[model samples]
Target: MTAAAPAPRTPRRRGRPSRTQTETGPATRDRILEAAREEFSERGYEKTSVRGIAKTAGVDSALVHHYFGTKEQVFEAAIEVAFAPALDAPAALEEGPLDGVGERLTRFILGIWENPATRTPLLAIVRSAVNNETAAAVFRRLVAAQLLRRIAGALDVPDGELRAELAAAQLVGIAMLRYVIKVEPLASADPEQIVRRVAPVVQAHLTGH
Candidate 1:
């Protein structure tokens, strides 16, 4: 038989190959994070593990460690993603007159929880936070650093941080009652009505009026 022509060889890229198969792209990192969130949500922070997250993500535990370092780090990253939307609270505070800051913030925050698109992951983070101190620390650090501190800086008051925290307390209480705990009329009340009622309290916290 006559010899067939050989297939052409493909050239390899110049850079060193990644050490881990899962290190290829941001997609894998995001996959790990999503898996971590689901794991944390279902198991709570106390019970969730890097191995569990890796299994859920279809990656090696070493890969999860490579991406996030530890379960706490993974949990922090997951909370960061879940809380990303609400981090814009500072922008809402600065968007308009300081006098109306409370209502604007209240409306903006509640709007996020009301939207089904955002609520699911947020619920996961909130549940994990309420049940676990470690998870709570992660949530608090991000909120305090990225959300509350920014809002406080906008006000320039000596007690700005405290006020920001108070506003957060008011908004968080509403979220707990209406969304997490699902208590009574507050849960079923019109969004507009809740906005009207709660905004004033939030406003008083932020502006001291």
Candidate 2:
């Protein structure tokens, strides 16, 4: 007689998916960042938590930790995203005559605030940074290390770092009043009008000639 039919094939067993392996790299990171931005915007840094972000992102809290490490790191990343345009300010400043650098920088910074897309996230970051010391530290580091240092380093002057900080202070003050505090004339004035008024002061700080 012919050999008995081959034993019935055992059903293949499927293993549980890995939390880390399933969602690795940029896609997962971006998703977490979007969720972080939303949470930070709605709840502010003081109230926002990793668990809350994870819930918003539909991922386990551990997964959020795996990607970003801490809420501070997540906020920094979100700030980077919101201020991406300003991060490029050094390049924009370098592109033009030194005399015009201030105008270019002013226009670029104000442009970011003028656009609703960039403005909304920026408001979140500024608001949180103002209220939370941890958030403020992150913001200060990014501004000092990324944006200000680059501009300062490019300058052909002594005390470049100080000059850069001074310039940044001017711009930051304007942003706070116009966008955050909603100061009357500044809040309502046209963006170009503000740029025209402020650019010279920034230029003096930067060039100092």
Candidate 3:
């Protein structure tokens, strides 16, 4: 024949999609948390529902429950997400001398509150904690489970458990005043000054003297 039949076009093979892709596992979790955060911020604990967050996250309502168990658990996770960034500080001291650990830790904690990326979520939890005992308990549990427990273990000091709790209280107090409450001077002061002044107090608390 004069014209040969054109070779049949090959269909492109598609790559297998990941089960734990970013839109899944951690990313899905984050999306749920962020949606939960917005819902909670606008509606508070009593009004916010898992279904609302699921709709907002564009996932099945059951998927939110699968990852978070309940609305309370989702709230807890969202609260924990607010503090997860600061939890990295103890690791900074894990491999080094504890002498200046307070300064680094203080800087890190304050930096998160100062950062717009992290501050809004933190404020949401702070507001919720102040008005709701359940929210407060969730906050306590998050600090104890996610942050203070690890910090106590990493620290080298007597009464590490008690010391870590106290140190947490001190830093948390500063966060409340400067960021949450918007107190003068403390709020307006430079970050370095705040860290310098507060670090020694946290250091003494951690070191027991």
Candidate 4:
């Protein structure tokens, strides 16, 4: 008599909750980006293509374009990722008194380079950036826009951006000579020695005293 047996409760559909696009989108994007980095690193920017990235990622070229759009954009994404740890250099300035900021930033940035794990990708990025203008542009954005500009912001001084650039020039020069080009002396010098010598110079730039 009651509610005509409540319509035999249709076999409650039961299965694992399906993954949503939002959940999977990042993984797909990250895979594509990782592929982009390897391609650009091995093949260089000119030779690396969206198709190549897609192939390496085991995705469709359309998906690569869909996520990053254009080869240049993919290169930019890869540059951003490769430089990610170094990009945190700005935060080192915030961790302590401004007076010692130079050393903090110097140690932090160089520490990233000293670690072989982090340095390998950066070396590949720099090599590619050297040979291609487009690659250079992407790398420049990492340096100027992402890294130095943020460092400049933390300085809170007149011409902070310029000062940051100057400091960056010194550190970057060291990285190039010691790490990238593997030049003598610098390449062979003690890490602590490089930090000690360079910190004061960088401090002078960041703080005019």
Q: For this target, which candidate reaches the highest TM-score against the unseen true structure?
A: 1
State the lDDT of candidate 3 residue by residue for 1-209, as single tens digits.
59998999766334322333334667887888889989888777777888899899988787787788877889988877667887787786575678877777787788888899888888888888888888889988887877888888888567888998888789889999988788998889999989888999988887755
Candidate 3 TM-score over all chains jointly:
0.79
Residue 198 in candidate 4, Cα distance off native in Å: 1.0
Clashes of 4: 0
Higher-scoring candidate on TM-score, 3 or 4: 4
After superposing candidate 3 on the true structure, give the runs of residues whose Cα lies further than 4 Å from its correct spot: 1-30, 59-63
How well is each residue in 50-115 modelled by candidate 1, as lDDT tens digits? 888989998878778777886889899988998899988888778888899988898999999999
Per-candidate TM-scores read 0.88, 0.87, 0.79, 0.85
TM-score of 2: 0.87
**What is the overall TM-score of model 4 with all chains considered together?**
0.85
Cα lDDT tens digits, model 4, 1-209, are 55655566445223321334225678889998888888887888888888788899987676777677778888888888888898788888999998998899889989999999899889888888889998888788778888888998989999999999999888888999999889998899999998899899999999987
lDDT of 2 at 181: 94
lDDT of candidate 2 at residue 33, scale 0 to 100: 93
lDDT of each: 0.87, 0.86, 0.81, 0.84
Q: Residue 177 of model 2: what lDDT?
A: 94
Ranking by TM-score: 1, 2, 4, 3
